[model samples]
Each structure stands twice: as C-alpha cells, then as structure tokens.
Target: MSEIPANTRPLEGPAPRLKAPAGATDCHIHLYLPGYEAQPGGPKIPELATVEDYRKLQQWLSLERVVVTQPNAYQRDNRALLAALEQLGPDTARGVAAVTPDTPDRDLQAWHDRGIRGARIMNLPGGAVTHADMLAVEKRIRPLGWHLMVQFNGCQLNDYIDNLQRLESEYIIDHIGKFMPPVPADDARVDDILRLLDRGNAWFKICAGYEASLTSAPEYADVGAIARRVIAHAPERIIWGTNWPHVGVSRDNYPSDADQLDVLLDWATPEQQQKILVDNPARLYGF
Candidate 1:
C-alpha cells in the first residue's frame, strides 16, 4: 500500500495466552468504504475505510468481538455500517450507529435485533444536534435501552453538559472525559459534567494514547491516571478500546502495543482488566 510514514497502524499479534475472562470485547474500532452512501447536499467524510480492512485488523489484534461505530463518513445514511454489522455475525460483533433525527422505531428495532446497541453524537466534528432534535432522537431510541454516545473534547462537553443530560437518557463519554488537568472537580465550570456522572447514567472509555499523553509517549502513566480515577469511582461503568487502525494518527516516539497493554494490566487487576477489556462491552453492546 501507500506509505506515508505517519499513519498510525495497528499492531499484529495474539493475546499472550493470559486467560482473559471468557467473552472479552473490543469496544471501539472503525471500518470504511470509498463512498459511504454519499448523496447530494450531504456532508462527505474526508477519511474512509472498509469492513474487509476490519477483518484483517481483527485477526492481527486478537480481539474476540468488536463494537463497530460510525466514523462520520456515512453522512447520515448508516447503510454501510449496518451492512458490516449484518456480516459480523451476532456472536462476534455489535455497534453504535449515526442516525438521523427522524429515524423510525421499526428501523431501530431491526438494528437492535442485528446487534447495534447505541448511537454516536460527534460533537467535535462540527455537527449540531439541537435541543429539540436531541429530545426527538432520544424519544426514538429510549425504548431500545441504548445510550447516546458522545465524542467531544472535555471543554466542549463542559459547556453543554446540562443540556446533554436533559435528553433523559444514559450517555457515554469518549476518551476519559478528555480530562484536562489543573481543573479542580470543585470548580463550578465542571458541575454540569459532575451531575451527569453522579446520576449514574454516564460512562467513559480509556483510549487515545496521544490525546491523553500530549508527547506521544508509549508509557502514558499520566494519561492513564485520568482513567484510573474514573474506574475507581465505578469500575463497571468504565470501559476500554484500541481505537484500531489508529487512522490518520501519528506513531508514539517509542511505540509498542505490549507497552500499552502493560499499562492497562498494571492499572487494573486481572478481573478488572477482563471487565475493562471484555465483560462490560458485552453487556453494553450485547455482543
């Protein structure tokens, strides 16, 4: 393939034969096709990938199951994502989808049966979900027992935290609340974010090596500290993901997947690691 010397590539390997609790899951990964149902007047994703690509990645990474998510490439037609879900087989995969404001109940039900468990709200990517649209979207999905997954910088989340929670639904925070250090939990600025977590309807994923550690260090203890605190509060609510393909990502100055796993295993006990690396995602995604 084309070599850019800068694209973040996934590491290939098998699980070190350390007995992970049965049924572990990889909570995040992306797949793409050249055109994800592109349409006139619709926004097209600049980056794209495919399912055939994902199969190779799964084998290389030794992940038992995957939570396939929409990567903003599909505009709003999730056909490509849903097709990938259909082919992944129920026992090995599940997904979160990007749905339109007017998606119907019957269609959502069909997706649920096919193993899609959540929806993604990408705040960082300039898309807007208005207050009315938020309620409508929640209304459509409420009966499915799925949460609204949000991916945004912690700063932006802090701005709209209250309104986000008002959707009257559970929510997932991507990448350790994107925690920025030096902001005390006591500050009023974060009170809205605090209330969401306190209500027991919020969860977070510990991914993003670069985002957590600004310097691209593989031994990202400081970055993991943010995750550890969240786990301490509610281990069951915390989850983990590989962010595979690392697409458009830069390699760490010193790179190693074993190093990343080492930090994760060191951060949590064997059982907790299973929950983080395995059990929780199964329950949440129905994998």
Candidate 2:
C-alpha cells in the first residue's frame, strides 16, 4: 500500500494530558485542499491542510468529532468545505459554511443534507459575510435550524452589540471573543460577552488565543483571563476547538495543539471540561 502523505505542516506532537471524552468535538477547524484558488480580497491561502492531516491531530487529542469551519480564504465559495465534509464522513463531522442572505434555499438544504450545521459570519477583513448580513442571513438559515459561527475584533464587539442581540438563530462568538490586544478580565466589554451569553442563544468558542493575545504563549495569561470568565459565566454554552493548521504563524512558532488544549482545560473544572469538550458541542452541532 502507498504510504499516506504526512501534512507538510506536521500535526502530530505530544498528546494532550487531558484525554478528550467520547463525543468530544473540535468545534472549529479549517481544512484546505489543492486546486481551490484563494479568492481576491481574502487572506492568502495557507498550506494544504487536508482531512488526513487533521485525522492525526484527532488521534493525538483523542477527539471523536469535528466541525470544519469555512475559512475566510475561500469567501463564499463552499466547494472546499463540501469536499471536506465528504472526506471526514457525516457521522463524525459537521461543517460551518459561508453563505450570504441571498443564498438559495435549495443550496442551503443541500448543504444541510450533507452535514453542514451552521453558517459562518467572520466580520474581520477577508470575511465574505459580516455583521451587516447577520439578521438577513439569520432569516435565511433560521428555518433550516442552522446556527451562525461569528468572528470579529472583540474590542469592537459593542459596535455590533445591537445586531448580535437581534439575531434569532443561535450564534457563536469565536476565539474567546478574539479581543485584539486582549482585555482585562473585568473590562466592561467582558460584561458585554457575558450579557450575550445570558440571552441563551449566544455561545462562546474558546480557541485560537494566539490570534488576539499580546501576552504570547505557554501561558497566554491575558486571553486566559477572559476565557476563564466566559467559561464561568456559561459552561453549558461553551465549546472548544484546535483551530488546526493555525494560519499566519510560522511553523517554528506554531503552538503545540496539546499545550493549547491543556491551557484551556486548565481553566475549567473536571465537570466543566466534560461539558466544554463533549456535551456542549453535541448539543450545538447536533452530533
């Protein structure tokens, strides 16, 4: 048999000391395949991050399920996300795709049938759908029972607070609110996140701290403070992810996924760990 090609960017490393519970899900990850051109106005495509590569990380983390998030690099072109769902299998994987308010009903139904459970609204540069599209897109996906996975500069979360409050479908705020430069645990903006969580439809994903943390890693103390508070506020609504093939960072500076998981798990109680790792995602993504 031909040897399986390892990822050009290695995914295997030290296993996380916190063994993932059965049904534990990586609630966010992006998978890249060859032949998909990076669209204009989007971020440059990272190295090919295939299903095979992610499988290694899954084994290393002892995870059972995954949610493939639509990378901003592809914009609204969901061909890559669709292809990944096929490779990962519907039984163990789900997807969050990029779709506009104008996406046809037939296409939405088609994606749902294939195990796509949510729509992504990345409000940063290169995101195809932004906060402006939130309610309209919600109108389109609400009937389908799909949720929204949202990401933006958490520092400006208040700028979009009204719209976030207005969203009818369940929505997720990605990357521990992704507060650029990171905020104090007691900041009023953290209160904004907590308020949204109280609304019950809003959820928080704890991942990719490096994207917004100024404190650097091994202990992203700044991001950890915020993550702990968010988890404490709504452990039932919290979920975890690897953000694998972590883009932008050079390979030498790449975080060990094991260590990242440890850092977040450290912030949670053993019971909260079970909910964050397994229960919450199963409820949110319908796994």
Candidate 3:
C-alpha cells in the first residue's frame, strides 16, 4: 500500500481520553483506495484514505467495529467499498453501498455475503440516489435485510416528512440531520426529526458536526446542543461516527479525531455513550 499522505489525517494525536467500550463501532466512515476513480456528478476524489490508515484511527479511538459507507466520490460504483470490507475483515466491519432499484439481485446477494448491511441514499449534490428514488431503492434492498443511510439537508425535514413516514425499511438520518447552517435544538425542523424517531423505524447518527455547524472547534456548541437533545429524547436509537478522513474539510481546518470522540463526554452520559458507541450499532448493524 502507498504511504498515507501526511496531510490526509491527524495520525499523530494523543489517544482520546474517553476510551471506546469493547465492540464499539464507528457507524459512519468512508475508505478510499488508489484504483477507484471519481465518477461524474459527485465531488472530486479526495486524498487516498486507506484501510491501513484507518486501522491506526481505530487503535487511537479504541474502536473495534466500523460501518464504511460509500462516498459520493465513487457515485454508484461499490468496488472501493467492497475492497475496504475485504481489507478490514468481516468480523469487525460492515458496509453501506449505493445501489439503484435496477441493481441486480445477484450483486446484492454477493455484497450481503461480504458483510454489507445497508444501502446509502445521499440525497445531496453528489448523491447517486435522491428522495424520488428512495422508495424504489428501498424496495430493492429491503428483502436483503438492508437498512438505509439517508443524508440530506435536515433543514428540509418538514418537506420530506411524508417520504420519511412512508419508509418501510429502518433508516438512519446521517450527520444529525445534516441541517446545513444548523438550526437550534428547539427549531421546528428538529421537532420533525423527533417525530420521525418516534415513528419507531428511524435512527439518528450524531457525527460530522463540522458539516453543518457555524460554531467552531473543540465544542461545536450548536451541533452539540442538538445532539444532546436527540440523545436525551431517545438514547436507544442513537449511533455515533468519526466521519473519518473528513474529505470536505481543508487541511488547515481538519478536526482532531480524539476531540471528535471526546465530544460525546459533553453530549451523553457514560451509559448513553456506551449505547451510542457500541450497543446501538451492534443492534442496528448486526455486529
């Protein structure tokens, strides 16, 4: 494997003060290898983020399990995701790939056999599947016992409420609803998120706070407040992630992985942290 570029990650940081519980899972991440080229209609390929580099991250954070989601850079091509799963090993890793309604059942079965447990629907600019195709794609993956990883502007939760209510397969809203220019915890949009969670099939992933936070740094106060509220409302339904390699961030603004994990200290209690880090993902992803 090629050397991971020095600028790609903060690989030399002190280990997180809050160690992850055993069987702890980082429920959202993306791994990139050299051979996969960026497809059209998505963001440009980021620096190579290899499984080798990620294993070091796992060690630093004390994370034993992972859920590697397909990055928009690769669009609907799942070869990179499959390759990462193979490298990370099925015992400790699972994958969420992008698939369309037309994806072959044979291929779906093949991916399932390789430790894939979910389908990703990133309904943003570079996303392969949108809200319009969500039900169709869900129909195709539902039989495989796959859940959906849906990411879009959480600010529009009200607009998408009907489709969310209609989802039959269990689904997770990525990045704490990914409310671009995130709203306050009391925002009506957050209430919409709470309503969906109350519906019993929806989950909330609290990660990537920098994606939507206007607030800066070690605290990310705005995002934390919202995360705290969500965790308080339904601790059982929450999961956490590092959003590792943080492709969208500039090198100068790259976040500390240890800090990312430690933020849970502020947002959740020890017991709730246990659930967010281990129990919740184990149940949701069949770890």
Q: State every prediction's TM-score relative to the real structure.
A: 0.80, 0.96, 0.96
TM-score-sorted candidate list, best first = 3, 2, 1
Off by over 4 Å in 1: 1-20, 34-48, 126-132, 180-195, 250-261
| Model 2 agreement with the true structure over 64-163: per-residue lDDT tens digits | 9999999888889999999999999988999999889789999999999999999998888888898888889989999989999999988998798999
- Per residue, candidate 3 scores C-alpha lDDT tens digits across 80-171 of 99999999998999999998989999999999999999988887888887788899999999898899999989887777788888999999
lDDT of model number 2: 0.88
* lDDT score, candidate 3, position 105: 95
Ranked candidates, highest lDDT first:
3, 2, 1
Clashes of 3: 0
Residue 145, candidate 1: how far off, in angstroms?
1.3
Which of 1 and 2 is the better model by lDDT? 2
Task: State each model's C-alpha RMSD to the native.
Answer: 4.3, 3.0, 2.0
Clash count for each candidate, listed in order shown: 3, 0, 0
TM-score of 2: 0.96
Question: What value of lDDT does candidate 3 attain over all alpha carbons?
Answer: 0.89
